[model samples]
Target: MLKVIFLAAFAVGTVLADGELIILNNPGSVHFEGSQATNQSFLKEVFTVVLGYTPKLTQPWDGVEIRDPFLLPEALVSIVIEGVESVKSPRGKHFPLNVDEVEEVTWQAVSRRLEERDTNNTLVRIRVGDGLDALGQSALGELKPNSVDPASLKHLSLNNEEDQKFIEELQLLRAIAQKIPSTVTANSKPDVYWFVVSGLRPVMDLHGKDSEATKEALKLLNDAVNDLSNAFTDIYNGQVVVALFTNDANKLRNTRSVESPRVRREEKAGELETFDAAAQNSSDNLNTIEKSIQKLATDTEGLVEQIVDALETTTQDSEKSTTESDLEERKDDIDSMHSSENDYDPGKPITLRLSKRYSANYPVIFNIFLWFGIVFFFSLLAICIAIAGMDPGRDSIIYRMTSNRMKKDN
Candidate 1:
């Protein structure tokens, strides 16, 4: 009777295996100098839960496989596999993944409870994850969503002695990526999943673009690129990509053939050196552009304050303030300032936050300037009058002009 009960329970457990699980890890195009063990460990942990099986550790660069064989010792009996492939997509034509063709794959158990599903019945979906390091995650969490404060950028510029715009951009990219769903479900089915990782970094330089600042930007960008590349080495299952661009002639010259090209470019002589030169020039240009952008941002902020005050003042003016047409125009101006709102999207190429929440502040400096100018002008006029009164020739003219005798003499 005890043996019969044991057999019945074993049969029940096998029947209860209701769903299939898959875990995948793919390497991106660019390889990092260091980063192997961490990625393997991450993959092992992810698969251990997803697939009810222990992984056979091997070199990630070569390839590893797990099988769903029935003869294997039934110690939880789940299979896990890892593969590398080149994923082709029309959307990201110039993406690093598109160029490198390195991807990882695995299969895991859906959950501890369900086991009926198998690899044949389930559609496997795969994607990359935009892995954020501790610093990256911390930085992103601190930033406001869809809230690109121009003031914040100015503050960053002033505080960051290194002038690390690339780092700032990286933070921005993380915020943008976070808005999108992390996992992709195959055919809208819950059983299958794909995870993705998109890397963000700085592009190189161009021809005739040699300067110290550009060189520094290039160095900073390269450092980020290298750091990110190394970070991905440990995340074995998700696709990894390095984001590089050639938006301008100079950028093209710098990155033409250096590595992954995110932008279209024409081949030039000494592309590597051209890129190096462009990277150097980019620093100076960036400083100039940053200053200009800061000034514009400040002016816009001031304008916003003035508009808000005007609106409040008119609101209080009950009957004697601005007209309906003028108020409407003011509203229109405010709306126009955020015209970029009409073009916000997650998948769009240019992700710029043109519409942002603004605050109103007292115009202390402006008011002080106005009051001081008025008072100084009046004081100067009084001094001139006093000087004229003390002058004998000028005093006679003024005194006689007001006198009854002076009128008779005239």
Candidate 2:
């Protein structure tokens, strides 16, 4: 995850190169303070004992002798090359590249030189692309360095294959990796670095301690290495990833710490409590709503029954026969009697007439009473509805229990 994060952060300025060299700490000169004579003797003795090959005094670049144990003497060759040295500094005298004692003599310088060479190669690519685009247009003129070019890279030319290759390689490298400064801590102190090699062989220091935060960090690094090794199948490829771990693990481990178990538990409990309370309240509201709906159903049924009873009584009264013929004749003489006697049919269609004329004539008086009645009735209903909605389904108990358990877990 960390690696992913880093890659994203520096995505803009990254490049990929064909052959990559990730140097964690540039191999620097080992300073052995003494006279030149003493130093030379020490180096000779050291190489003889360590390499099991006697080295003789020879000119610079001419490598010393080595006797192969398995190969015959005639077959095993002794190699030599050009060698030169000066007894004085500030003149032409110089130490070997990796053996320079200057603090600034680091792998970063070497890497940067390599990067710039790659960058030069990349510049050529831009020209190539531009040339391709202008194939039908203008001439793809030869490009050369301007007069303002620095001493470190005055010789590089766009036309030169070596220079072009260098730049191209650098551009490719930028695609693959970025020179990011990673912070690693040791004894609470930190060292900021630009190169974080993914793989290099893990070797113990003088104290035999792995470059890691602690014991746990070491174990994690080892485990990661093993996993990567198994997955890659290519040991060399696997080492690249391991290199990244080996260099940063110790510093990364020291700077980082894990959360305590108790704190995490408490946090979970609080969350559970909050959720439980909310669920319980919602359940109570649901139950209350259900009860109000039931009451409304009952009231509506009662009103229907009263209406049916009133209609039935009127019907019976209308059917009663009168004893006096004069009264019967008078009732028969009423013009609306026939219409009033019309049967209330349950199956047949019925028409109900509603008029706004009566309401319009007494608007002010009716509106006041009508609105007041509606508001008062509904207000009371709303209160009952609110209660029924609260615990209508009786689910609050279950919700509360579940909530409580969640709170504890949290």
**CA lDDT of each prediction against the hidden true structure:** 0.37, 0.31
Supply candidate 2's per-residue lDDT for 78.
9
Ten-residue region with minimum lDDT total, candidate 2: 74-83
**Candidate 1 — what's its lDDT?**
0.37
- After superposition on all C-alphas, the RMSD of every candidate to the true structure, in Å, is 36.4, 36.5
TM-score of each: 0.19, 0.20
lDDT of 2 by residue, 98-214 (tens): 111111222233224334423421111111222223322222132221222223343344354434433333232232121111211112111111222121212122112433322
> What is candidate 1's CA lDDT for residue 50?
30
Stretches off by above 4 angstroms in model 1 are 1-167, 170-208, 237-239, 249-410
Candidate 1, position 339, lDDT: 54
Candidate 1: tens digits of C-alpha lDDT, residues 12-71: 542332111221122332222311112222333333323334333443421222332232
Candidate 2 residue 128 C-alpha distance from true site, Å: 44
How far in Å is the alpha carbon of 401 misplaced in model 2?
A: 86
TM-score of 1: 0.19
Q: Candidate 2: where are CA atoms >4 Å away?
A: 1-257, 317-410
Candidate 1 positional error at 322, Å: 99
User: In model 2, how many backbone clashes occur?
Assistant: 59
